[model samples]
Target: MQRWERRLSDAAHALTNCGETYFEPDLFRRNVNQFLTIIRTVTFLIAKDKANIPDYEKWLSSAIGKYWSGDEVMLWAKESRNYIEKEGDLELFSSLSVALVYSYFTENDASIEIGRSELLSGGIKKLMRLAEAELPHGVSAAAAVKIERRWVANTLPNYELLQSMIYVYSRYRQACADLAEYLGIILSTTIPTAESIGEGEVHQRRVSYVKFSDKASYSKLTHRVEIDRTITPPIWLKDVDRTRPNFEVYAEMAERTFLHFGNHLAMVFVFSENGTILQHLAFTPFDQVDKFIFWRDLAERILYLRAESLIFVSESWVRKDPGLLTPIAQAEILGEMLHVHEIKRTGEVSHKAWDIERVGDQVSLAINDNDSLEASGFPNYLVPIREAFTRIHKR
Candidate 1:
């Protein structure tokens, strides 16, 4: 264990200076990749095998002799003895303590020895205290750093506990990175254009759509007599107030419009767009509308939904709009509102206008009628959407 600790400390120092020492981007990337891979592998191994073991007493003694050569090892041993006495289970408590220590070492190798001592000295109990700290507005990154700092400060004292802590910290870091990447992809992409709609000013419009099926549960007579036939409405139309006009209203409108019209399911798509579809959103409907809306609420809270420009699509709509819809439109609206797109005719939509020359059966709306508008000059938003569709769909 002591040899491993020394190796880890040496590796950390090497990694920290790799870019400066090597002066190579590829080497830097490779080193970081290797470090991350090793961290992950060690974490998995400890979690799966050694997490329940007692402190490595023999290993610690050998490490102290080989490395410490001072009173530091004696103090650590005394603290470990006290911890074992209080916990009543040497194996479990020591293992957990050692895990916490390893986490600190991996993150901050310079303070590895001090970090080990902190873990043994009841510093880790401060996790709850730090967790209770108030976070400032719009300072999530800072807050996260603070929390990690406090956690590391509290856990760094115990050398034996380092492995387990490393495992947990690595998992958390990976999860956060994954989430950030997903959000980046969504926010950085261009907004999708709707078919047959004229380009209009970009507004944060809350939009949604619902599907009605012939196999709907509600009776036709009830739908026709009680509800306005023109307004293909949901079964629970009375619950929504479209006058206030917000995301909640849009969601309710979809449910109320589709509930009683023999529709088995309802898929909703919403985005900021102007044209006949946006204008006609008021009259859509469904059958069997439940007031306690779960899926819609969940969808609204997703990262993509909160993005500056996001499109929501229903599965039923995707089937109808297949081969003509752009990727943004498909991503936002399909599956949630409708199923995935099924490709049809090849080269029905041209990529030339978008600065893309690739030709294939990519699904995109025909811009033939709008060529005159293009000649007259369309908005810049359309250009990116067209280019993205061409680049993305050419597989």
Candidate 2:
């Protein structure tokens, strides 16, 4: 590789290393400074290569004007490197933020703010108590919680260090590409993909408590909680190894709010397209305290995913029973413009069902299924429900 290419590769390597070292504060700080220095070196190499290329000074000056001139982010990157080399290591602000995930929380809720030093020193044990004290009226601890540790440049406090670094890396990558094109030099080394750079936000952790657990079990679980408290984060779920298949499925289900009517159901699956199951949720029955949670979460997920079809495997009682009717209505309102297929279940078999759908301007749930799910273009949806019923009968 040429001198300019080598400098560009070094900058990329520094960025890759910077992302991996967020958990190690000292190393992370060093990597950021190295990344900044390498970025500056890329342009410096271009300036020195002027003898080989025509009008080197004019082209380099114009390129700088086009890329880095008047750009605050790029200017900051240059200044940060100068500060590190001349004065000292770049100063950074580190912080830890704790967010409690409860069904009752609305948009008005705010996450608890804790200093990095306080959390790292010995604040992990206080998480539960801190969370409970600020919980709203009648609310205890969260069903799930998210904790994030972030670092930002003390000068540019608006952007997290990773985000700022990613932005600067992308800018420099473009500048280098333009310079190479101008010099008619073909790069042998491939640039990093957009997805790799976009993953800069994954600096957090998550922990969830079991639903409907007794106080003793909850307290015991809380006492054993340990936060590495490093400058790092995740979605809400129990203390399960994410590498495990079951935990992956559980996390996806929690994120998607995949649901089923009864606890006895063997599996609850959400399909995206072509019968591919997006999520296979555990059919855990909600008690009285959290029954509303399931419907609300499910509705929110439906809206978020912009899902068009919904096949609900529900017992016959859910339709005629007054107590079960409210949640169904809530689902309809929140999940508007949805084509709903309600498969009514009897003792051992599912009967005909109804199709609730949008009509012109308004949405309606009308009884319309004259045949079984197998005949209604939804044979795949019926398979799991039948399998669950088969298992229950065998028991």
Candidate 3:
């Protein structure tokens, strides 16, 4: 690869992998310095090649005046490289702590912003609380903890390490493009913009599951119903024709899907007559409003797609006092079936299912609540767990 090509590849690789080793301070520091070195090398190579120009000094002054002089980020990038090479690893202060959970189901028992030094000293176990932002609402406690870390350099405290590196990399890459364009030389590869490579924090979110004593029951709580979004289109669907519909084949596929996701939370699969999946929506939302919007949109999409058969399965929280699922806005849809299972905090389960069908161009909702209640006891750990986490957070 050419110099510009190699730099782009390295920067892209660095940004993509930075999150993997972000918490390891030494590895992170070395990565940061290596990225800074890329900036320096790019600058040095551009300056060295100026000897080829007839009025090299004039061009150099013009380029600096145009790109570097006024840009604080570019100026910082230049100085940061020099500083790190002479002064050892970049000075970084990092901390990993749990961001407190706030949801409709759980009360905000703890409301404290942990200081950086304290958070670092506390460690993952010490900072774990009753719940986390990533966990769905209504579980007695968080099944997974979201451990957040921010790496800030001593010199640049305002912006975290990832953001600072992105800005620096972007500024230098732009300079390379501009210099090449000015010299009328065609580069080997297209330069990618910062946003395309990732402009924000290098590592976005990291979730680690907290093991509980009742492993089987807690597994159900943590198990989110989802179709792997990363999946490519299945080969079987490739031959299905949208113009000609086959409702029978589609219905079979929908039944298989229901069996797969029946135990978990939210899911909707809409299929056309020829067995092609028009849309498969499966996301577990923690907020009530988002859940409402998700179902409402599902209903709208079914109508829009003119789906032959659709399966909608959802899990809901039931109020122990009322023995009823908590009120959430519902959207009426003409579908094969709507199955809703409810779980109370105390580990009791009840269900209300409806057979939704189209009769003479009108939709009918026939409700059935004959399903037996499941008495699988919920783990008796909330009180002790909450107390333990509260004590940790306080300390």
Candidate 4:
């Protein structure tokens, strides 16, 4: 219990500090169910004291949200559950607290952003209020002197209690995940923490869950499972088709994408079927071949996902093996260098299109007469043969 209590404190602190939040609508609602389950089981020792319970219970319902059916409180267990279950938001409000409820039913970008804000502060705070109100040591001190039917008071362990509580809460959280169906497909990736990155150590990890939803749900979900000492986690999945031209896909997507507009750090938005506007920083150039391959493979994996795919990757991980995923934008970033590598490796050039301008045995790039480039620029684009040369030879 102490472990859970401390974690609950940690969660509260994190929430207060981080103003933003995200919640899968389904996951939010199922938790509400768990909350209700707890409330229903809390029986009173005194019948007269039960009278005051109705007023507090009614306040609990209304305080959580006006969305709930604002009606009189009933003590009957079966009837209480039945009425709540019939309510809206996928019947999420019936079991879960109103604070945790976010108004998300349709699958879209705007809806998610709005719901996330609510979940972070309003939802979490409300949940805390509910817990404190019911518990004997709660902030409001709402629970009366009568013995609780649901909670049996006993002398708890004095030492090493927090460790056991943590284990219990983890299972409870896992159980919540097991019992409730997450609304959309989750695409996740673990990015490296700054200090350990590029130092040859997997010293830190952070996972991003890109929840995708269509008319229905996807069968498999890969989550970022965290542990005590491990810094890097795992990536979601991989892209099987390696033969496709990655840049052509980018070139063709010119109409749908822009470099500067919208969520500019748009690498995360690659999984959306609708094109994304990426930030320039997201295109950060990498000289290390492995890191370049990793970033490119992440793009490839998301490109292949038909359902909402949650991606997970770390500093130590490129989404797939170097050869398995095609590097699109990554290629463009080092197109000339890669072209040179290919020529050096195979003793021939695969791309017959790029007008080659060689500077003393090293080949540079001249833009082809492709319509996309001709329209976008002043034309006559030149790329260096090797970035290591530290020189740009212009004609």
Best by TM-score: 2
What is the TM-score (0 to 1) of candidate 1? 0.16
Q: CA lDDT of 51 in candidate 2? A: 89
- What's the lDDT for residue 252 in model 2? 36
Q: What is the C-alpha local distance difference test score of candidate 4?
A: 0.24
Per-model TM-score versus the true fold: 0.16, 0.46, 0.40, 0.19
> What shift in Å separates residue 356 of candidate 1 from its native position after superposition?
42
Candidate rank order under TM-score: 2, 3, 4, 1
Residues 1-395 of candidate 4: C-alpha lDDT, one tens digit per residue: 22222333333222222111112334433443343343333222112233433454553343222311321122222243445567522221111112211111111112111233234335434444554454333112211110000101022221111111222222233222221222132211221211111112110111111111111111112223244564532221122232444333432222122211211122222221122221111323232322222343333222112112221111111122223133322222322211111111111112222333446655444445452323433211011111101111110
Count backbone clashes in candidate 1.
58
Candidate 1 global lDDT = 0.27
Estimate, for each residue in 230-258, the C-alpha lDDT of model 1 and write its tens digit: 87544466656666634445434433333
Number of the top-ranking candidate, with lDDT as the measure? 2
Please give the distance, in angstroms, between residue 373's alpha carbon in candidate 4 and its true position after superposition. Answer: 22
- To one decimal, what is the Cα RMSD in angstroms of model 4 from the true structure? 26.0
Worst 10 residues of 4 by lDDT: 144-153
Between candidates 1 and 3, the one scoring higher on TM-score is 3
lDDT score of residue 174 within candidate 2: 55
lDDT of 3 by residue, 1-395 (tens): 44654675576566545655677767777777777777567656666666665576776676555435655455566778889878777678874555333222224323333466466335434434334333333342323333445787777775556755665665566556556666686544555444444422333342222332121211111222335878865655545454533333333333344444343446555554445555556777654433323443343333223344444455333323311222222323223554543222222333445554456655555564543333423222122222322322232
Worst 10 residues of 1 by lDDT: 196-205
Rank candidates, lDDT, best first: 2, 3, 1, 4
Stronger candidate by lDDT (2 vs 4): 2
